[model samples]
Structures are given as structure tokens and as C-alpha cells.
Target: MLRPELIEFSLDNQKAELKIVPNLHGPITEDDLLQLLALPDFSYLCPLHAVITQAVIQVNQLHPQDEGNIELFFEIAERRDAEISFEIASDKMQASMALTAAYGGKSLGLRDVLQNLKLQRISMGLSKAKIEALLVEFATLSPGEKCHSVIANGRAAVNGSPAKLERKVSLARERLLQPQHNSDGTVDMRNLGAIIMVKPGNLLIEKHPATQGVNGYNVYGETLIAKPGKDLKFTAGNGTEFAANNPNQLIATVAGQPVETPSGMQVDDVLQIKNVDVGYGHVDFKGSVLITGDVGEGMVVKSHGDITVMGFVDSATLEAKGDITVSKGVIGRQLKDLSLSTKLIAQGQISAQFVQYSQLKAKGNILVTKQLLHSHTQTQQQLIVSDASARRGDLVGGKAEANKGIKAVAIGATADTKTELFCAMELTELKQQLKQLDQSIKSMVVAGLNIEAQLRKLPPKEQWQADAMMVEQVKVMLEEKRRTVVFRTQEELEFEALKLEIEGYYKHYRIDALKHVFSNVELHVGTAFQRTQREHGPCQISNKNQEIRFDYSH
Candidate 1:
């Protein structure tokens, strides 16, 4: 086997600086210094700048232009700095050391000392005893060495990866010990490492026990909770399968507990997760939301199509033109309490949960759901929006008028008016009246003829008096009935006018129209579900009591 290299040292600025030489008379190169920085098993031996520069010059391979570059000068100054960092992170230390050395004052004899080392391959002119001491102090001279602490950084890795470095490993005390973990109860030596990293399979936590590492973790439930950590519990849990929350920090997995996954679902046209531990601020996605897990507070989710939640949503607004389905129940905000849209369909109802929408309809009646309380009319058409439960920022549903006068049901504050008044005259009633009128007209015709005949039969005075009384009474009754028919026609026209207005304002919207487009579109002012009793403050999140259905029109 090849012999290990030895190093020497000196004391300056309360730090021991090492000095080393090749076993041969050759000078060290940049590549040789790089190898020293990456040697994981042995400690490092860094020569003073004065020694390295002298050796470079002696080789006659030093670039003349290198001395003129400002960067080069700064680098040279950093190497000569009085401060010495005992860190193995050579890449990280290079910049720091350079800055420190550039500003540090140098001893007056640096040039003379450099020239002396240049003439010979001696150990910076230090005694062998001092050199040996430095080896012990720096730990580079040992047959084996190990560092307990590790620092991981992109810059620290320099031009390569930290994992791929060569290391000198120590033999274990026993040939083998128990396996770290095994469901099969057998050993797997394939996973062995010089440094065994301990990872917990799971932790059997106290039932509702207080979380040790974080606050708000006092156990109220059987399972251990991470307590809404700064990094989202669900976001990291789903977004990346393999992610390190605390860089360079070991992750301890608790047994039988699901770790937090960060999903990439967009919410309310805003809020997107850029990475495992990072999310874009208040973003908008017009197409689809693809989050891996739950959405945090105050986020808004809007979709043109259907909405799919991989996890839960807390105190967040969700809006969609099509359909909505959440894998888990919503929390932090009430569905029935908030002013949500009226046009919505969910497999579930808002029961102790948030039920905000413009108009909402479930397959079943709502007992605990607040949106279904105090409905305007639930029988005439299909669904009637409740009046008692909807809160501020809620939009209204469209209306369908059949028997209960005009009721506005859908969003956009529209109404539908359906009237059953048609002069209160059935064909039988009108036909009967017409028969009487016809009889009166026929009798009048006969009376006039009889008067003509009588005039010929008797004296002129008697004939005239009898004709006047009979014709006058009949004329009065006939005129009264005609006036009644005319009045009924006018009333019928008025009802028709109101009905036309319902169809005219089909899709027209005003004031935050995007927020309140009722689904049914057919609305009746006096008949449909209207917020007429109270003006719905500005349209926001809501679920209407009456679901606007598109059955038919006219």
C-alpha cells in the first residue's frame, strides 16, 4: 500500500495553518489541490499562499497575465489572509477567505519568505517536529479519520457531488447487529453504508399528546399532527414524493402516519405551488387546478370546467361553471353561511361546512345545510332558494314562474312571472253569456217588428208608450255585459306583458356579472327565488336555496 502524506503547521491569528510537500521534489498543481479539498477520509492540509505561489513560480508554468487580473489579485490576497477557516467546504470557504485576506494586513517579510521556499522543496523551512504536530492538529496525518457533522450546499459541492466522494471506512465492532428495520424480519446487507443514516419508520405518538417539536400540536385526536407547519402539511406531502424540508437535516418518519405532501392544484384562479416547499403568490389558472393536496386559507379557486380537490380546502373560495367534487370535506369556512354562488352541484351538502354559492341544489333535502332554509317556493317548479340562511356576498338564482306569482331564482337578480288569470271565464262561462246576449238581440228584433204591427192595429199614442218601456230595459242589461268583457281583456293583456319581461332578460347581467350568472336563466320577479326581501350586498360566494333548473320556457 502507498504511504499516507504528512503535513506541517504554524500559528498565526490563533489558527494553525498547515504546510505539506510532495514525497517527490515536484511542485503541486491546481488539480492536486482540488483532490486535497475533496478527500473525505483525511483532514485537509492547506499551505500558506507564500509557499504555493513560490512553488508555482519555480515550475515556470505560472501565467504572467494572471498577476494583472483584478480577480486573480483578489484570489491571491484571499489565500494570504490571516483568518483560517477550518471548514471542509473548500468551495464555500474560497470566496469568504478571499474577501478576508484582501482586507487583512500582511507581515512585512512575506516576499523574502516566498523567495526562500522557491529555491528549495523544503517544508516551508519548518522543523520536522513542528510539521508532525500540524499533522496531529489538522488530523490529516492519521491512518483514518471521520467527521461527525456535515454541511450540504450547492457551492460546497464545488464541481462535483458530495455523495460520490471516496472515503476511508472503519470496521464495525461486531460482524453484524440487528437490522435497522425490517418488516420481513430479515437482514439486508445491501443497504449498508460506512455511515449508517438512521431513519424512523414511524413514531407511536401519544393520543392527543402535545407535539414535541412544534406548537399547536397538543393531541386532541388519536393521530399525531404536524400542526400546520410553515411548509404546508399537504402541499409537500403530494407535490414531491422525495423532498427535504430542512436541507441537510434528516427527516424522521413516524410509523403509521401519512407525511405531508405538497400538491400542485391551483385554487380560485389563484394560488399555485411552484415546488415542494414553494408556491407562487396569488396566481390565476384559467384552465384546470392540479394540486396534490389541501389548499390553505384565503385562496380562491375558479375553473371553467369541473373542480377536483385532491385534499381539503380551509376558509377558501371555490367557484366553477361546471361541477365540483372534493376528496375531503371543506373546513375553516361554512358553505351555507358564506355568500357563495347560486349555481352549483356537489355530491355532498353543507352541514357544519361552508355552503357559499350563487345557487345550490343537492339530491336530498338539507337539514343541517343552512342554504336550504326558508325557501321561496319549492313545489311549483323544481328548486326554491332559501331566504333565511344565505349570507353576504352571495349571488341569487334564476326564476321559474308557474303558480306562485313572480319568483326570481337564478343569479343576476332575475325574476319569472307566471299567472293563471284568464278573465275567470271558461268556454262554458263565456258561451253561456253569449247565448243570453243572442237571445236578447233576437227579442229586440221581434219587438221592433211587433211595434210596426201594433202601430197598424191601434192608436199611435198607446203603441209608442208600450214599445219604449220594453226596448229600454233590454238595452240596459246587454250594454252592461259587453263592458265586463272589455275590462277582462285589458287585464289579460297586462299579465302577458309581465311574462314577456322574464324571457327578455334571459342572459343579461349587471354589477359583477361574472360572480352571479344564475344557471337556469328563466327568472320571474314575483314567482322565482329573489333576494327581493333583502338586497344581497355585493355578489360574492353563495348558494341559492332554489336550484335553477332549465326545464322549459313559454
Candidate 2:
């Protein structure tokens, strides 16, 4: 028998070879060869098992000179487990697969790789051509190299769009619809923020329908339903109607100013004119009035709706049930005209560039773009004097009252311009009325007591003989007095409750002066008042603990 030690094993880069030394002492047998292969150290060279089996079978026929010289047993190429890893992007819009080279096993082909993918249940959006190409390329790749390719793609769903509505409508009959510019390149804000007017049957709004969205496909070939676009119906408000031909088209039913509201669009009757001169007379209209030119001195313009003056208003009486906007300043004669009162009254807001020597009142806010000089202005809401570009936008020689508050760039000019700002006047008035009601109630109580004493002094029904009618009259008077006292008492209670409500609102009252407040400026919050004899700057005034306090800290 041949010794197992005579067999030697060696390995190259990828080849395993074996050599055997000739054993002259005993002839080599198949059992001897099989015993040599069973050595534990040869297990790492298992790829050469088939070749070793053949060599063992031929060992008995080998000559001594053959000597089992070094021969290739097996090609030991690298063996790698077939890998197919998948990757998906965060947005789920794409997917990829990575293939590491598979060597030394049954040769990996396209069918094998695809079969493995199918077994892994990769059914959605599979690119067969791409997978085959990747497999072919992977076949050419060297050992230790990897291949990556996008395998599946997902489509994004298209979102729906909203309907478009016309924002602006043309008013060809009305001039000054847009602001005019002077030759010197300065914009004439006189026509700025102009009202849009529409005649009967004129188009006011045109609605465009929403567009339908396209459907999308996902990587799994699943249909992704897109959201349908929203549709809106025209909400026709007062004095508006939809066109007979087109439901989406809105038209004015009356010749008026077009106003946009949350519910719908409306047209209020509008009176348009070139100027308010002597020819225009004392214009009194039941609707809105638009003046393209100046309102001449002593002209009176009254309207149930808004009044817009594109030019200056000089010594005119302008009253409106709605808002009043004067592009230019309201200028009164420097010499106070006792006969003609220069006033501007509005149920809504009043906005003007400036006001001088005029009286203005509004139920809503009063906005002054420039100075408010020697004017008596009052509003139920705020009084604001805001001139952003001016160095000084002061309230000089004016008594300004507002129910809420007053905000001004400056209070009183540098020369001690005596400006008085009164805030929360409604509450103050309520309090005063409550006090008066209390006094009236007390008077009524005393009157009732006097009447009761008179009634008691009257003779009883059994003793009354001569003046029964007089006693009856006295009794009736006493009953009436009692009823009057009760009514007055109830009124007093109601007024007291109202006064409490007003006080709550008064607590939020504030007077803000953004810039300097000169001497002789009076600040009043409810009934509390403070006169600044010395200059104080950039402060807010409010009533705190029955005292008027000024906060100088910004």
C-alpha cells in the first residue's frame, strides 16, 4: 500500500493541482489512492474532487516514471452567492436592483436571474429588457465588481386646479378709471383707487371652469385616481344677475358702482359728474356720487351712498350715507365763515389727503393722509393721521374724537398747536347719560312720594260726599305717577347695563402718537384728561385707574 504522505497538493491563483511521489516499496492501488484523498488537509480543495476521483481510478495503471507529476485538478474560480438587492427612492417614484458577480457555480444567465426575481415576487412594473441587458452586462463583469440598474419607475399623480375668476372689469364710459400722470412724471393720486362703474347688462364678472386632472400610474401598475377640480356657482347679490345666455357670466342689473362682497358682487346706483360747480347746483342724489373735478366753494353735495371727490373740496358741505373719499384736501376759507358751515359727514369712513379749517364726522374710521389742521373731526371708530413720506404729519389746532382711539404721526405742531384727541367718547357719553338718568329716577321717586301723600290726604270713599269726582281724579293721577316711576326705574336699569358694556369697550381705548407731541396737546381717555404743558415725544395715552397715563416707552 502507498503512504498518503506521498501525495502533495498545491494551489495557484484559481487552479488546484496535485503530485504524487513514486512508492517503490509497494505498488499503488485504488484503495491506496482513495485513502490518500481522505486526508483532512485536502478538504479545502473540494472543487478538485471529480479530478481526484479520476486520478484515483487510474492510479493502478500508472507506470513508475509517470510519478503522478503535478497535474491540474480543478480551476478554483471564485464562488459568490447570486445576489439581487432592491432599492426604492424616498418619493416611491423609482426602484433599482443591484447584481454582484456570480462565479464558479452553474453559469448565471438571464433566465436564472429572472427566475430568482420572480421567485422573490417582483411583479410590479418589471422591465424585462432592462433586466436582460443588466444580466448580459453582469456576465462580462470581472470578479468582485457589481452592477446596478433602475428596474421600476412610478408616475406622479396630477393634482387638480381651481377655477379662475375675473378680477377687474372695464368701465369704458367712465373716465379717470385709472390714475393720471402729469407731464413732469409725477402720478396724480387724485384718480387713484377709483370706483368701477357698470351699466345695465354690462359684464361684471366672467368665470372660467376648472380643468380636469389626468390620472397617473404607479410602479405596481396600480391606477392612482386624481382629485377632481372644484367648481363654484355665481352668487348674485343685490342689483346683480347672471347673463341669460351664459350662467357663468355676471352682469349688472342697474347702472351703478360695482362692489365686491363676500356673498357676491353688487351694483349700487352711482351719479357720475365732471364737477360740482354752479352748473351742478346743490347736488343731492339718492345713490353714490363721483366728482371728477373740484367741488366749488359753497357747493353742497349729499348722497345716500358713497361720495368720491377726485379733486379738492373747498368750503363745501359733503354728506353721504356711506363712505366719503376726497382725493385732494378739504380746504376751508382761512377767515371763518359764520354763515356757511364747511363740513363733511359720512355714515361710513372718511378718507382725505388733508383737512384744514373744516368739520368732519363719520360713523366709521377717519383717515387723513396728510395734516389735519384746525379741523373738528369725530368718528365712531379710529381717527388716523398717517403720512408715511412726510417729515411731520401733525394734528394742529384740531379737536379729534373717536369712540375707539386715535393714531397720529404727531400730535400738535412744534409751535404749541393746541390739538385735543378724545378717545372712547361713546363710553364717556354713556356714563354721563347714566348719571342723568339716575338723577331723573330720583326725581321721579320724589314726585311719586308727593303724589302718594296727596292721595292719602284725600277723603276716603265712604267719607267723600261733596267732591267725589275730585278724589277720583287725584287717585287716577297717583296711579299714573306710580306707573311713570316704574317706567323710569326700568329705563335707569337698562341704561346702567349699557354703561357697563361701554366701560368694557373703553378699557381697550388708546391714543397713539408715533412722533413728537408738543405742548398744549390734550389727551382724553373716557372722562380722564391730561394737558401736556411741556413737550413729550412718541407716546401712547390710556386711562389707567381713573388717571390718564402716558407711556413713553415704545
Candidate 3:
């Protein structure tokens, strides 16, 4: 055996050199070697006057006629190899075999010479470590998980076979996963992905708690989402319909391309929400907090602009600098410390049973059955009824200490200082008492006595007479409540008119209303911003109670 193209030469120091110049970076195929070896002019460099002729021993290794041909083949191979400068990367089989057969087939240093070629590649700057990393061959199919895309080789089972290795399909998994093969040709395992691998008759699951079939996997034409809970858990199978698992924490797709975000962005972009539902965690947005769906418990939301919630704000504190508009009623039965801190404009009424310290405002008149619209102690805080509003407040406010009574419907403005005659003073007092009665009626509920808890026995009609007596007492109490309420209202209104005079000094008009805050984070509510007035129907149910008014000058 000889390499017809590789040549043998001697250096100045008389050291022999063997060289081969390969044209392309191709493995030496059998057909290529056959064409070179079949040359009739090949060999003849070696003259074998063997010692086997004298002792008649071991003549089987070399034929006398073939000695010249073998030398000629080596000489031509080495000469051609030197003419070009192709260096050997790997001397797999035929090159090693031919060189050994020509020199001395079982040479002592043959293995060492082959080993030096692998080292020579490293010294030439092509790291064997890198080359070894790139080249890999496997017998079985890949597991096919989506980790990376690397070139793969599927080789023939028989060694030294002329047939080529089958072309391998590039898979997604990082590892070169394979199926298990027994000596008797029994393949008992084949991997589908990291999660599942199968064999001929038995399936060896790679993960525990794994389901056995793909019965519940529902794949839409667009996306395949793994529903892990309930009866949706199923093991993956080998089919075009099934895809290998993608185990990334987040997969975001934008436009038709995927946008890979670098972990978390800056504060300006931390709370980022796209159109898709977050499905699990509290979805946050740096922009206006909008909930297309109902907010679950333990979800806190805050925003700079207004918060528009299409669902209930239950057990959750939704806040914003702009108005908070809740289309649905708030549900917590009673919010003990609820505080709505803006002109809370609601298309729906607040039904949290009772709010301890909460407040709401509408540029339009307020309308709510179980909600109260309280006046602030020190602003020009007054409940005024709009002409469009149908629901009226049982108006009450006064200051007993100042001995001033509130004027209903501007009985006296700052422009006019004169008082009316005392002709209908008695009738006006009775009318005030009746107005107080209405407020009391709005506040109270019919009592329900637990009959089982009745410890003292009394006459049946006695309970009814006692109720009647309580009613009369209530009438007196309401009248007194009205007087006290009116006194406070009058004093506040007088101060409001006075504050307007002071504020007018700094405002556009000689007659003024709004005060100027030198500094503070105060919201600038739109002057024409109208909050909803009715909770039930299309009527304005305003709380024009104290009847405070401060019309602004354009």
C-alpha cells in the first residue's frame, strides 16, 4: 500500500520528510486514492533484497516484484506533496496505512508520527481544541431541544465503509443527545426533547411527574401555549405538530420579529405592559394605569394620569393625580380608612357600604345614596346644587359661637348689607325645623329589634307608644340639629365672602373666588371638568347643601 500523491524527500541534514498537498479541504475518498494508486508508472523506489531470501523467513510481508513499485509510489507522492504546501490536519486511515505499509507495516514510531500531526495543527495556530469542538459525529438522533444550532454528523455503523455518513438535521438542543443501543441491535431509548425520550417498546421519561400523552395540548394556528394546570399536563411527542420546549423566562415578540430586552430597563421603563395579558403577576404600566380586566386581590396600582378601571376596585387602593374613574362600584363592604385624594369622577356610585375618612368630588353636583360629600374645614368648601340636578341635599351648616345663621338662596350678599323685615320669622323657623327633619330622615334607618334578645316583658301596645314618643323626641332633636348646622354654615359663608375679597386683591376681578398657593404640589383640575352627577339614571343629584358659590371672572 502506498499514497501515490504524497512524496518523500531528504533535508540538508539527510533527515527524511514525507509531504502531501491536498487541493481542497476534503477527506481522501476511496475513488480518489484508487485513481492515484492504479497508475502503471507508480512505485519502484525500493529494491528489496530481503534477508528472507537467505533464511527463507517472512517473505509473505512483501513481494519481490512489488518492492520497486512501492518505492516509486512513495517518491512521487512525496514530490507532489512538496510542490504544493498543503499540511495534514488529520491522517485518519488510508494515509496512515499506506505510509506504514511502505516503511515497515507495524513501525515502532507509527503511532507517535500520527500523534505529531494533531500537534502540528495546534502549532500552526489552528487549535485542536477548537477543531475538536466543531467536529462531532453521533449514531442516534438528536434530542432536538431549542438551545443552539450546531453542525451535526451522523456516521455509518461499520468502520472503514466506503458509504458516506448520513446528512444530519440540525436540531435546537445544546447537547448531542442520542438514543440508547444494545449489542443485539435493540434500541430501548430515543429522546424527543429534554423532557421526553423513547425506545422500541418502553419509554424512559427524562423528567418525573410527567404525563404520558399529548391529549390535552391545544395548539392554535398562531401560538402553542403550554397549559400546565388541571388536565392540560401532557408529555411531548415526536411529530411536526409538537415543538420542543423553549425554557426562557420571558419571550417577547414585536412586529414580526422578536425584540430581546436586556433584563430590566431604566426607571422610566420599568413598569412596561404591552397588549398581551400578564396572565399571573400584577401587570404594571408607567403610563396611565388601565385595567381592561378586574384587578385581583393584593394588586396595587398607581399612576400619574387618571386611572380608568372597567372592573371593581375591590380591596385595592387605586390612585392617580388626575381623576379616578371607576365604571363599577367599589366593593369592600366598609373601607375603614379609605381615602380618595382627588376629584374622584365616577360614572358609577361608590357602594363600599360606608367610607370612614374617604371623600369624593364632582365639578357637577354629587349623587350617591350611601356616600357622603363632606365639606373641608378651611377651603371655600361648600356643597352647591346645580339647576340641572334633580336630587337635592338636606342642606345644613352654621356657627353657634358666632351667632350667625346661613342664608338660603343668597338672603344677603356682600353687595347688600340690609336685613329683611321680621314678618315671617315664625314660619321661617318652622321651615328650618322641617328641613332638619328631612336630613335626619335621610341619615336614619328603621331599627330591627331581635325579638329573641328581648329580656324585659312589656305591654304589646307599650312598645308601639314608646316608638311614637321616640319619633316626637327625634323631631325635636332634628330641629336643634338644623339650627346648629345653620349657624355654622352662615359663619363659613361670611368668611368665604371675606376670603374672596382678600383673594380678589390678587386676582383678575375686584370680585374674586380662588386663592393662590405660593408653593405646594397642588393639582390643577380643569375648570370645565364635569364629574358625573347621577349614580342611577340620567338626572343630576347634586349636594348643593351649604349652597356655596364663587363664580370665576373670565
By TM-score, the best candidate is 2
lDDT for each candidate structure: 0.30, 0.71, 0.27
Which runs of model 2 end up more than 4 angstroms from their true locations?
A: 1-194, 198-238, 241-255, 259-266, 334-340, 388-392, 428-507
Which scores greater on lDDT, model 1 or model 2? 2
List TM-scores for all candidates, in order.
Answer: 0.17, 0.46, 0.19
Q: What local lDDT does model 2 show for residue 147?
A: 93
lDDT of 2 by residue, 1-554 (tens): 55555655443333334454333423345455555545565432234445655655544344444564423232222234456677767665677888876433344677766676666555567787888888888888764468989987777777466566784564321222245677899867554654567788888887787666777766645677665455555688667898899987888898788654433466778788889988879999886788888898889999876788878899889998777888777898555454324789987778887888888999888888778898888888898887544354668886889888988888887788788888876665677777887787788878888888877787676677457687678778867887986576466556655666766764567888888788898888877888998887788888887678888887
Preferred candidate (lDDT higher): 2 or 3:
2
The candidates, ranked best first by TM-score, are: 2, 3, 1
Q: What is candidate 2's local distance difference test score?
A: 0.71
User: lDDT per residue, candidate 3, 329-390, as tens digits?
Assistant: 34432234543332233221211111212244322222222222221111112222111122
Q: Give model 3 RMSD, 1 decimal.
A: 38.2
